[model samples]
Structures are given as C-alpha cells and as structure tokens.
Target: MYKLCHQQQVDNACGFYAGHHMLVIAGSKNIRKPEDIVLSTGPLDDWALAGLRESLAKFIMSEVISSKGEFHHPTATY
Candidate 1:
C-alpha cells in the first residue's frame, strides 16, 4: 500500500483487506466490509512517504506514554 500510494501520489489512506479471486480497494472514511471496499488512490503520504510509518509509530508511542502519565521524555529514567 505504501508503494502504491507513493506511485499514485496521494494521502488519505485506507487499510487493505485481502480476498480470494479478486482485489478490492477502499478509502479511510468509507468502509462496508473487507471485500466491499471502495476503490481509491490513497496513502496520504504528503510527499514524505518514507517516514510516514515511523513517524506515526512515534506519535502513537507518545500517546501511549501520555496515557501512562508520562507526557514528556524524562531526563534520566536509568
């Protein structure tokens, strides 16, 4: 999907769900079923595709830390 998104050049991604004997596509905002996905040209890379996944992962980590009562990085947790 990242490669597809980069090739097509778009953002606003949708998660892919594989199926048998066919290919189905969908967008982030609209989903009916795994096989009932709407066709799309997405991934919303903002032209920074290479870093998107890592950046999102870091963002999620930050959110998790915030939920755990640690909103900022500690100077020394060793």
Candidate 2:
C-alpha cells in the first residue's frame, strides 16, 4: 500500500488522489472553502459546485498519478 507522509495526508489534493486510487480517505476536514480557492470564479449552487470540485479533484489526482508525484497540490490546476 502506498502511504502518504504527514504533509501529504493533510493536503486536500493528496487526500482526493488517495481516495480515488487507493480507496483511502483522508483529511476531509482539510477541504478548503470555495471562497478560499483561488481557482473558483464565483458562487455556485450546491450541486454545480460539488460537480466542479469533483472534476477538479479528479484532475489533480490524475496529474499526480501520471506525473509520479511531480505534479501535485497547490501546483496542479484544472
């Protein structure tokens, strides 16, 4: 099993990647508010926002995986 270090475990991007690929959920509490996300354009309804977040999360996860950790959170963008 791939294990994340403390820093990775606490990161939202890393948590998302682990959840999808490893079936390991971590750092749910670390999810940032929409307003806190610089990539967010504006307010979105619950469902739309959820979809956007999910897409972004998946994109980040894919990037990290394909790049072998070269692409990661705070750097991986949609």
lDDT digits (tens) for residues 20-66 of candidate 1: 11233423336545544444444333454334456556765775445
- Looking at candidate 2, the ten consecutive residues that score lowest on lDDT are 34-43
Q: How displaced is residue 36 in candidate 1, in Å?
A: 34
Question: lDDT by residue for model 2 over 39-76, one digit each (tens)?
Answer: 22233345754654787668767766555555755554
Candidate 2 yields a Cα-based lDDT of 0.45
State in Å the error of residue 58, model 1. Answer: 0.6
Candidate 1 lDDT score relative to the true structure: 0.40
Residue pairs in collision within model 2: none
Q: After superposition, how far is residue 6 of candidate 2 from its true place, in Å?
A: 38
Each prediction's RMSD to truth:
9.9, 14.8
Misplaced by over 4 Å in model 1 are: 1-47, 65-78
